[model samples]
Target: MSFTVYNFTNNDDVKILHQMGQFQVLQWDRDLSLAPWTAQQAWFASQMDVRRRQLIANLDGRTGVTLQAGAMQWTAGQIQATTGVKGAGDLLGKMVRGAVSQDSMIKPEYTGVGMLVCEPTWQHLLLVDVAQWGGSIVLNDGLFLACDSTLQHALERRSNLSSAVAGNEGLFNLRLNGQGTLVLESPCPQTEVLYIDLQNDEVKIDGNYALAWTAGLQFSVERSGKSLIGSAMGGEGLVNVYRGTGRIMMAPMQAATSYNTLASQPTS
Candidate 1:
């Protein structure tokens, strides 16, 4: 019942970017100590604009947190983990959803009054309020990190088949519904993200730069120009289009780049 974390919050090297409800996103301002050779690598990483960030999940005994499988790094106090499975049928359903959505099949849930920390990564951690998205939101692939267990999860399919095949996005997306906080692993920093609010309007993008959007929005893929000749002349082909009224979170930069790939490489 009694616990303390020393040199965690007090450490000058760590910067707290966001904290809400039961989650906190922190970033290490710099790696202070390193060998000469590794220090050179760190300097190059700095020049390349890389970041070291982590997510902290704080359970309050009454509420539990659901995380992507294999995301937990460490935990303290009276914490317990469960598969969040109800029955054989539920497991099968989750498996199907996971297959189409490209998300972890069985998300692990943690309960009890404790602090759970996720593995550190260079990817930016974003804390989103589901309520801000009108109690529901659909996320692009691979963005889901963690969420309050109170939220409901479902698969949201594309508006049309062409949208799935031509847009470069898959057929189904993971949708979360309810009033809770959701954590996302973003390829771009929050500062670089563009937030768009639409009112019976539409927006088009040449690539999959959208991170998340309101679940009610109608999404599809379409030509950038009215005709094939125009599209070819404009040098633009299919584009992702969102219609209706909702909010969108878009990153101006491409999601796949050297910065995101660096996480897969071993680090000293």
Candidate 2:
């Protein structure tokens, strides 16, 4: 019937970084540590970039939110959960998609007047509006965090066999359709992201840096240049190429390097 989160506000260390409609993204200012690690924590905090854990989808009952299975940290007030599966057919479809995509089979949905908190991590949290993304957004294997109940989820495969084999990404990616706000846990900070909007054009990347792209685009693995010799001379073998008119969000840095930098920026 009532809920009050003490010492969590913009005035405090824990601030509301962003809010879209009913969804609120709360960011902690500093990393918390135990007494034994105080000295180490202080040294690291001062020397390295602080990677704060983010909370997603603080609900207040105007609408409902669906979360990746087991993502919920805590919930308060009048909120209830559902399996988000319509029937036996939907369950079967989810199971099949889960098998290929490696996503949750039965994501839980929560509704009514309450605050839904998600497990915090060092990963960056991005709140995307599906309508602005042309009503469909396909994400790399493991980014889906949470979304409004209005959105729909499906599994989409790469455009060709070469993409599946050479791109070094999974055969099936998670696709979110319909209209609503979707929460994403990006590996890299959004400040470092490069968004490419193509109009009947093409863009290529050497690695799996492209996090999410519009479903309308065609993604395949192709040589860097026209001929085999040219590709070899270019020093780039096969690259993931996205063609057609659509939008893509790419993190320019290599995945492992960026993650290490975020997770543990070593002292210089």
50: Cα error in model 1, Å: 2.2
What is the overall TM-score of model 2 with all chains considered together?
0.87
Residue pairs of candidate 2 with colliding backbone atoms: none
- Residues 200-261, candidate 2: write the lDDT tens digits: 99998887788889999988888788988998999997888899999998877645224555
Question: Which numbered prediction scores highest in TM-score against the true structure?
Answer: 1
The runs of at least 3 residues in candidate 1 whose Cα sits more than 4 Å from the true structure, single-residue gaps closed, are 47-49, 256-259
Worst 10 residues of 2 by lDDT: 259-268
lDDT tens digits by residue: candidate 1, 1-268:
6799998856988888889898998877778767777888788888776867889988889889999999899999999999999899889989998888779999999999989999888888888999999999999888899999999889888888774686566888899999899998887887899999999999998877899999999988888899989988999888888999999999888652234567775533
Q: Could you tell me how far off, in angstroms, the CA of residue 151 lies in candidate 1 after the best superposition?
A: 0.9
Instruction: Rate residue 59 of model 2 by lDDT.
Output: 68
Clashes of each: 0, 0
lDDT of the candidates, in the order given: 0.87, 0.78
Pull out the clashing pairs in model 1. none
